[model samples]
Target: MKLFSLKKTFFLIIVLLGLTATSFAISNDALRQQLKLFSETLSYINANYIEVPDQKELIYGAIQGMLSSLDPHSAFMKPETYQDFQTDTRGEFGGLGIQIAVRDRVLTIIAPIEDTPAYEAGLKAGDRIIRVEGETTEGMSVMDAIKVLRGEPGTDVTITIWREGLNVGKDFTITRDIIKVNSVRSKRYGDIGYIRISNFNENTSRELRNELDKLEKKPIQGVVLDLRNNPGGLLSQAIEVASAFIEPGKLIVYTEGRTATRNELSARRFDDKDRDYPMVVLVNQGSASASEIVSGALQDYQRAIVMGTTTFGKASVQTVIPLSDGSGMRLTTAEYFTPKGRAIQDVGIVPDIKVRSGKVVSDESSMDRVSPSAVPEHLMSDSEELDSDNGAPEDDLQLLRALDVLKALNAFGGTYSRN
Candidate 1:
């Protein structure tokens, strides 16, 4: 019986080895064929092109094509472009100060930074850039468009924009400037403390804390956190901002990726002196990424009433992978979800209270169009209007609704009174 068992075990082992060897051989053959095909294509292009293309340029173009095929956000940056990207994260750079993205194969303005050349020039959200410097942007990538728009401070660039209501494109000549973003601003609206976060940069949380400290000194009844037209920034800063309101150890946002395990980002610190007053968060189509993270977490916890239009649906987390060269690639590595496991990709966070600002032109439908009379008195402009230093517009309809919501909560003894 022992001899029979040994013979069976040996036979099984031999069969397993044979299967492994066959699988390895098949994989090796497929890889070799693919590499050969790639090499042949490169050789053909190098030999038959009208002009002999630089080998480095050809290789970089190939890399860019591969990354572009993945997603609109993924791109292979040249060395100088990569340097600019790093400088941008530091909250200062020389550019038109407009966040742009390719949406539906058209270069669309995400948002123009307040007080920047783009904002002052009236570049509105949803404005489609058709041409840059007389050159059509039909097949241009976001990074390419950015490169064309950015130049030395005081240099001018002409951009042709296709607005929603206009039949003919309008040309705007804007001079580039050094964009220095002051992410946080605060003001007191009667008894309510109003804070506006323009972007979530490295110093965002610190600036917010300082502003809050100043506001807390007064008899603040409620708080209004404005996040309109904030094309997001650092993920760490988002967590820190959310932690200011939420209790420690509460899950703020979580991320899932192909290679990495699902990771939860929880609030690690809490302010004991922080006011537990009723809160209202203002958001719009231009509030994205880290902005969505903050709003979604607060809404999920019922800690704040999110007021205004739906947010910009950009919940993917991008990781900048530096290449062996000085260049880097911004790759969408993971998708972010709120604490309740709700994905905000493409489908943005629906506001608890829907309030239209009348300043932005919605890309969703023509029905979203507001009459010129409905717009705020300060916002009556053919061009995009810039937010004030306090971040809230004068006579803004959305701000009025948010204040009303906060007042109702305050009147109800700090309880949320949702109708």
Candidate 2:
């Protein structure tokens, strides 16, 4: 933080900002008066306060308050938090490994990264984290929630969450670990390929390219590109990953804001791999940002049948600005659009085939009689992992639905038509 005269600190800061009411066309004198009022308020507080307040904290608090008023996504990060933010994009962190957002002033889980403590604990998307380590998260900022959830690896933090089916909130104890993600994982189901993209990190596009290449060698009939629970990362990776399926010279995703220029990005690579086969892109509420870009592009071109629930719909682009004090602030700069010029801000991409996730228990199975949420935390347990092969088989209804659609497309010679 740069030094400012104590009495005229707010006044000088405002003048340095040179902010004007552009839309309203308020005069320079009016703006100065507003700045003067701010300085006066601060001066009054400082002169008559019970104790000498830390001037640095006062400035930082002011910045945070201003950012918070802008939007849920924009936030002022302290130096340590800014450092952690940089580490997260590189795909490794000492944290709980969950993507979160603030919705309606409540802390909500976007998705838990695969193979992490949160995922292993069975924390699902749309789960409202009411408390973290007994601290109420009712109005906590996403950055603050992150600070609490992340710490030295091997430390434990218990969170209380409320889900749809549960009558009351449930507590889940999760141990923080070094979250190192291998973004792309694949399984071969006959002539069809099932690829689960857990999260899009620095290496997502490279990982995906290698996986697609390996699968193309076998010449699969169709492919299931799963983006369910993938809280997206790196816009560059989104474009690169989408390039694998979308044709070169075709628009993948674009962004525009009031002040920012419209960034029109298109696919660049096509010859290295053959991608004419039928595809089923699986998405859910957990699918956000980069995941939206991929699925939206594929759907817009009619290249794939999108299945599962609607996406998380985080279309706004945040530009992280580093401050002089090693701190930083993420400011919302733009809103992204799909190839078909669809604005996906609050309204997410809708799937062609809507399939909710659940297992179809046969009538003969005695366990079919059990209720979904018998107890608060009865939804899932360590022994009853939802995605694990070792646990009691949980049929992926969405995957099955996508496969059925894929087979239909295959039978019709890799072509699909919507009625």
Candidate 3:
């Protein structure tokens, strides 16, 4: 019996070795073939093309296609594109200062950053950018349009916009300026403290902390955190911000991926500031990435009342890997889950109070739009006629409703039982 067992062990070892060898050989062959195919395709495109395509554009397009094929978030970044990303994360850039994204192959305005040139020039969300400086934006990528938008401070750029609900398209000749995004905008509406966070960038946590601290000294009955039209940023910042409301040692988020170490981010002990305040978080289709982390964690832990539309449903974590050539890859590395082990990829967080804001041209009265607190039109969208206190006409109407919810919670004196 002993002899037979030893033979069986030896056979298993040999089989494992054979499998490893085969896998390694297959991987090498696959890589070689891919490289050869890339070379051939590039050569063919350059040698024979209708318009004599720019070599740099062709190379960048290939890289973008390669990454985009993996997932929507993973993307290639050239030097300028990478720089624009850095500026965005830093919460500052030079442009008309409008938040934009590509949807259906068109540049759609998500929102206008407060006090920016875009907001001042009457730019509104849902505006379709058709032409930039007389150049049609039909075949342009988001990064390409951004490059055209960004320029030296005080420069002017003409943007042709096809706005929804408008009788005729509008043209805005906006002068560029240095857009310094506060990232976190805070105020006191009656007894409720309201805070609007644009993104979870590197300085997000610190900015949020400062804002929270400012409200702590006041007799603020409740707080509203608005995270709408935020594309998300640093993961660490998300955890830090969530920890402010949740108790220590609570699981905030976790991530798992093939061949990646499973990571669990928990809320650590904070300084106990504003721990007893009733909190309401707002989110929408524009809230994603790190914003999802905060909203998901808060909702799962039952630490706050979430009021808004469904979140953006981006639960994948990306790592920006910088190469030697100043280019980088925003690669999706892992899928994140809330503390309840619920995957949010393609499934966004459901709000406790689901409210729908009115459209720009809807016949509904301003009273039909519900906000926890009274908000003026200028506080949200740039337009006067469409903008109303009910929070319609703004891209992030869900967040405004969340502020209203916080005001309601404040009126309840933090004594209402959460169901």
Cα lDDT, all candidates: 0.83, 0.83, 0.73
> Per-residue lDDT tens digits of candidate 3, residues 125-218?
5678999988888756566678899999988999899976777767899999987877786876555677888877677777888888887676
Query: RMSD, model 3, all Cα superposed?
Result: 11.8
Q: What stretches of model 2 exceed 4 Å from their correct place? A: 1-5, 8-33, 364-394
Full candidate order by lDDT, most accurate first = 2, 1, 3
* Predicted structure with the largest lDDT when compared to the true one: 2
For model 1, what is the alpha-carbon lDDT of residue 344?
94
TM-score (C-alpha) between model 1 and the true structure: 0.83
Model 1 Cα lDDT, one tens digit per residue, 1-419: 64455445445534644575567675676665765576567656655767755666866887898888988888889998887778777888899988888878889887888899999999987789999989999978877888889999999999999999999999999999999999999987666789999898889989999999998887787889999999898999999999999988999999999988999999977566655888999999888889999999999998999999898788887789888789989898999999999999888889988988864333656567778788655334311321322444445878867766665565546576444
Give the TM-scores of the predictions, in the order they appear: 0.83, 0.87, 0.73
The lowest-lDDT stretch of 10 consecutive residues in candidate 1 is 381-390
Residues 65-141, candidate 2: write the lDDT tens digits: 88999989999999988987888789788898899998777898999998999999999998999988888886678
Better of 1 and 3 by lDDT: 1
For candidate 2, list the clashing residue pairs, or say none.
Answer: none
Give, for candidate 2, the lowest lDDT window spanning 10 residues.
378-387
lDDT at 24 for candidate 1? 66
